[model samples]
Target chain A: MIEVNDIHKSFGDSKILKGITTVFDKGKTNLIIGQSGSGKTVFLKTLLGLYTPEQGSIVYDGRNYSDLSSDEKSDLRAEMGMVFQGSALFDSMTIAENVMFPLRMFTKQSKSEMQDRVDLVLKRVNLGDAHKKLPSEASGGMQKRVAIARAIVNKPKYLFCDEPNSGLDPRTATVIDNLIQEITQEYDITTIINTHDMNSVMEIGEKIVFLKDGLKEWEGSNKNIFKTDNEAVTGFVYSSDLFKRVQKMYLEEDL
Target chain B: MSYLHSIGQYFLMIKAMFHKPTKWSVMRHLIFKDIDDLIINSIGIVSFIAFFVGGVVTIQTALNMTNPLIPKTLVGFATRQSVILEFAPTFISIIMAGKVGSFITSSIGTMRVTEQIDALEVMGINAINYLVFPKFVALMLYPFIISIAMFLGILGGMAACVFGGFASLDDYIAGIQLDFIPFHMLYAFVKTFVFAFLLATIPSYHGFFMTGGALEVGKASTTSFVWTSVAIILLNYILTQMMLS
Candidate 1:
C-alpha cells in the first residue's frame, strides 16, 4: 500500500496539487479522475517521485520517500513500474528488446534467462508473435499491451499508468482496462492510474479519487459512484445523456 | 540572467554525466552504436569537402601568382598551409556542426517529445549518462576523421597542382617540404579536439533541455546549430590568438 499525507506542489505561482492525502491499497486498481488542468497528472507524478512536494510526505509501505538517500531512492524506483500515455516504448528497439530492457538494467540474469522471462511476459500479454516487430508496426492496442508487458516484466511492487486509454478505440480501451485490473489482482500491486475515461471509472475503478481545481472533490468506488450526491462528481460523471439514463435506471432499480 | 542560468545548467549536466554510470555491458552497446552514428558515418562528408576545398585553395593561389619572381612552388605551399592550419580543422567542423549537430539535437529532441527520457529516469537510470556519455566517448574518435581529411586535402591539392599545369610535381613536392613546422600540425589538432567536444555537448544540451512538441524539435535543432556554430567560431578565434600569438 502507498499512503500520501497532505502533499503540496506548485510551479512558479501556479499551484497544481493542493495537499492531497489518500491511500492507494495493494491488490486494487485506484483511479485518479479529473478534468483537464485539474492536477491529476501532477498528483500522479508526485506519487512517482517525478515531482517533489513542498509539504507532507509519501510513504510506500513503511518507508518515507523523502527520507531515503539518493541511491536508496533509486533502488526504490527500481521496484516501481510506469506506463506512459504514449506507450513510450524505445523507438529504436524491437518489442522483445524493449520488454527485456528493465531486466537487463537491474538484474544479473544470463542472456537465456532474460530471453525466457521476456518470452513469458510476451505470452502473458498475448504478444508472443510480436517479439521482432517495432513499436511503430504495432496497433494502438498492441502498443499499450507492449507498454504493459515492459512495465510488469520486472514484477514491480507498484504500477502507475498515465492516460492508458487516451488514443485507443472503445473496445481496445476496455481490453486495456481489464488487463490492468487483472494484473493488479494477479500481482497484488498497488496500481494507480490517471485517467478521465468515464467508462474506465465505471468498470475498473475499485477506488476512485476525484479531483477538481487541485482539490479532492470526492472519493468512492465504481459501485458507490452511482449513488454519490456530490455535485462536482455527479455533474462530471453524468454530464452525458447516456450516463444520466444509466444513473436514473440504477436509482430506479434500487427503489 | 537566463544565459547565466543556462551556463550553470550546462556545467551541471557535464558533472552529472559522471555520476551513477550505466552498467558497462549495456553501455558497451550504446557506445558502439554512437561510434557508428557520430564517427564512422561522418567520414564521407569530411573527405569530400576536404578534397574539393583543397583543390580550390591550390587554384586560387596559382591564379594570384602573376609576378614571375614568385615561385610556382608556392601553390603547393599555400594549399598545405590553408588546408592544415584553418580549412581542415575549423572549416570542416563548422560543416559538421551543421550536419552532425543538427542530427543529435533532432534525435534527442524527438526522444524528449516522446517521453523516452522520462521513461529512463523512471527506471532509475541516469538519463544524461545513459544518453550523452556514449556520444562523448564516440566523438573521441573524431580526430581520426580529421586526420583523414588532412591527408585527402593535401592529396587533392597535389592533384590540382599537377593536372592544372600550375607547377611540376617535383617543385610542388619541394614546396610541401618548405619551412615545414610540425608545431603547426599540433596546433590544428588542438583545435580539432576542442571543436569535437563542442560538437558533442552543445547539441546535446539543446536537445536534452528542450520543451514542446514536434515543431519545437525543429526549432531546437535550428537553435542548437546556430549556437554550436557561434561557439565554435568564437573558441577558434581565442585558441588561435592564444596559441599562435
Candidate 2:
C-alpha cells in the first residue's frame, strides 16, 4: 500500500498539487483521473519520485520516500516499474531485448535464464511472436503490450503506468485496461495508473481518485461513483451525453 | 545568463556521468556500439577529405613559390606544416562536428522526446552514465583517426608534388624531413584529444536538455553543431596561443 499525506508540489510560484492525501491499496487498479492540466501527471510523477513535493510525505509500504538515503532510494526504485504513455521502448532493441533490459541491469541471471524470463513475460502479454520485432514494427496497441511486458519482467512490487490507453482505439483500450487489472491481481502489485479515459474509470477503477484544478475532489469505488451527488464528481464523470444517460439508467435501476 | 546556465549544466552532467556508473556488462556493449557509430563509420570521409585537401595545399604552396631563390623542397615542407597543424586536426574536427555531432544530438534528443530517457531513470539507471559515458569512451580512440588523417594527408601531398611535376620526390622527402619538430605532432594530438571530448559532450548536453518534439530535435542538432564547432575553434585558438606562441 502507498499512502500520501498532504502532498503539495509547485513549479515556480504556481502550485500544481495542492495538499492531496490518499491511499492506494495493494493488488488493486488505482486510477488517478483528471482532465488535461489538472495535475494528474504531476501527481503520478511525484509518486514515482520524479518530482519532489514541497510539503508532506509519501509512504510506500510503511517507508517514507523522502526520508530514504540516495542509495536506499535507488534500491527502492529497482522495485518499481513504469510504462510510459508513449510506450517508450528502446527503438534500437528488439522487443525481446527491451523486456530483458531490467534483468540485465539489476539481476545476476545468466543469458539463458534472462531469455527464459523474457519469453515468459512476452507470452504473458500475448506477445510471443513479437520477440524479434522492433518497436517500430508493432502497432500502437502492440507497443503498449511490449511496454507492459517490459515493466512486469522485473517482478516489481510497484507498477505505474501513465496514460496506457491514450493513443489506442476503444477496443484496444479495453484490452489494455483489462490486461493491467488482471496483472495487478495476479502479481498483487500496488498499481497506479494516470488517465482521463472514462471507460477505464467505470471498468477497472477499483479504487479511483478524482482531481480538479490540482486538488483531490473525491475518492471511491466505481460502484459508489454513480450514486455520489458530489457536483464536481458528477459534472466531470457525466460530462459526456452517453455517460449522463448511463448515470440516469443507474439512478433509475437503484430507485 | 542562459549561456552561463548551460555551462553549469554541462559540467554537472559530466559530474553525473562519473557517479553511480552503469554495470560493466551493459557499459561494454554500449561502448562497442558507440565505437562503431562514431569512429569506424567516420573513417571513409575523414580520409577522403584529408587526402584531397593535402593535395590542394601542396599545389597552392608550389605555385606561390615562384622566386628562383626559394628551394623547391619548401612545397613539401609547407604542405606538411599545413596538414599537420591545421588541416588534419582542426579542419577534420570541424567536419565531424557537422557529421558525428549532429547524429549524437538527434539520437539522444529523440530519446528525450519519446520519453526513453525517463524510462531509464524510472528503472534507477543513471541516464547520463548510460547515454553519454560510452560516447566519451569511444571518442578516446579519436586520436587514432587523426593519426590516419596525418598519414594520408602527407602521402597526398607527396603524390601531388611528384605527379604535378612541381618538385621531385626526393626534394619533397627532403623538405618533409627538414626542421621537423616532433613536438608539433604532440601539439596536434593534444588538440585532437581536447576536440574529441568537446565533440562527445557538447552535443549530448544539448540533446539531453532539449524540450519539444521531432522539429525540436532537428533544431537541437543544428544548435549542437554550431556550438560544438564554435567551442572547437575557440579552444584551438587558445591552445595554439598557449603552446605554439
Candidate 3:
C-alpha cells in the first residue's frame, strides 16, 4: 500500500499540491486523475520522489520515503519502475536491449536467463514479435507496450506510469489500460497511474483520487464516480463528453 | 550557493561517469575517433604544413644570414620553439574543440533534455558520474598526446628544409637542436594539462545542464565549442607570458 499524508509543495509562493493526502491500495490500479495543471502530475511526481515535498511524508509499505538516505532512496527506487510520459526508451538500444537493461544493470542474471525474461515480458505485453525492433520501428501503441514490457521486466513492487495513454487512439488507450489493470491484478503490485483519461478510471479504477488545483477534491471507486452528486466531482466529471452523456443517462433514469 | 551546488553536482556527475558500463566504451570510441580525426583527416594538411614550413624557415633564415652572424640553424630552433610554445597546444585544441568538444556537448545535452539522465538517476545510477569521469580522464590525458603529435608533425615540417637543400643537414641540426629545457617542457606540459581540463569541464558542464529539446542541445554544442576554443586561445597567451618570462 502507498500512503501520502498532508503533502505540501510550492515553487516560489505559487503552491502546488497543498496538504494533499490519499491512500493507493495494493493489488489494484489506483489512479490519480485531474485536468492539465491540476497537480495530478505533481502529485504523481512527488509520490515517485521526483519533487521533494515541503511538508508531509510518503510511506510506501511502511517505510518513510522522505527520510531515506541517497542509497536508501535508490534502494526504494529499485523497488519501483516508471513509464515516462513519452515512453523514454533509450534510443541507442534496440527493444530487447532496452527491456533487458534493468536486469543487466541491477542484477546478476546470466545473458540467456535475461533473454528469457525479456522474451516473456514482451509476450505478456502482446509484443512477442518485437524483440529485435527499435522503438522507432514500432507505432506509438507498440512503444507504450515496450515501455510496459521494460517496466515489468524488473518485477517491481510498485509500478508508476505517467500519462500512458495521452497520444494513443481510444482503441489503443483501452488496450493499454487493460494491460495495466491485468498486470496490477496478476502481480498484485501497487500501481499508480497519472492520467486525464476517464476511460481508464471507469475501466480499471479499483481506487481513484481526484485532484483539483493541488488539493484532493474527492476519492472513490469507478462505480461511485459517475453516481456521486458532489459539485466539484460532477463539475469536473460532467465536463467530459462521455461523462456528460453518462450524466444525461443517469438523470433520465429518474423518469 | 548555486555555484556550490553546481560544484557538488560536478563531482556527482564525475562519480556517475566512472560507475557506468558505457563510460569505458564511449571513452574508447571517442579516443579512437579522435586519433583518426587528428591523424587521418589532417594527413594532407600536415604534409603541406610540414613541407612549406620547413622550406620557408630555412630559406628565410638563410637569406637573412649576414656573414653568418647568427647560425643559419637558428631558424630551426625558432620553428621548434614555435611548435611547442603555441602551435601544438593552441592550434590542435582548436581542431579538437570543433570535433570532439562539440560532439560531447551535443550528445550529453540531448541525453539531459530527453530525460535519459533522469532515467539513470531514477534507476539508482549516478547519471553525472556515469557521464563525466571517463571523459574527464580522457580529456586530461589525450590533449598531451595530441600536443606531442603536433610537435612531432612540426619536426616533420623542419625535415623538409634539409631534404630540399634549403639548408644543410648540419645547419638544420645545429640551429634547432638544443639540450632539453626541463622548465620549458614543464610549461608545455602544464599548458596541455590545463587546456585538457578546460576542454572537458566546460563542454561537459554545459551539456550536462541542458534544458528544452534538440534545439537546446545544438545551442549548447555551439556554445561549448565557442567558449572552450576562446579559452584555449586566451590561455595560450597567458601561459606564454608567464612561462617565457
Q: DockQ of all candidates, in order? A: 0.86, 0.87, 0.40
TM-score of each: 0.99, 0.98, 0.84
Error of 3 at A99 (Å): 1.1
**At residue B219, what lDDT does model 2 achieve?**
99
- The number of residue pairs in model 3 that clash at the backbone is 10
Q: Which candidate would rank higher by lDDT, 2 or 3? A: 2
Residue A14 lDDT in model 2? 95
lDDT of 2 by residue, B1-245 (tens): 98899999999999998999999999999999999999999999999988888999999999999999999989889988998999888999999999999999999999999999999998989999999999999999999999999989999999999999999999999999879999999999999999999999999999999999999999999999999999999999999999999
Second chain alone, TM-score for each candidate:
0.98, 0.99, 0.73
State the local distance difference test value for candidate 3: 0.78
* Model 3's TM-score against the true structure: 0.84
Q: Rate the local accuracy (lDDT) of all candidates.
A: 0.93, 0.95, 0.78
> How would you encode candidate 2's per-residue C-alpha lDDT over A78-177 as one tens digit per residue?
9998999999999999999999999999999999999999999999999988989999999999999999999999999999999999989999999999
lDDT of 3 by residue, A1-255 (tens): 999999999988899988998888999998888878989888887888878999999999999997788778978887888888788888767999889988877787888999999999999999888888887798999999998888889899899999899899999999999999999899989999998888888788889899899999999988788888878788877786878997678668756
Interface RMSD of each: 0.6, 0.6, 3.0
Q: Per-residue alpha-carbon lDDT of model 1 for A1-255, expressed as tens digits?
A: 999999899999999988888999999999999899999999988988889999999999999999999999999899899999999999999999999999999999999999999999999889999999999999999999999999999999999999999999999999999999999999999999999999999889999999999888899899989899999999899989989998998899999
lDDT at A157 for candidate 2?
Answer: 91
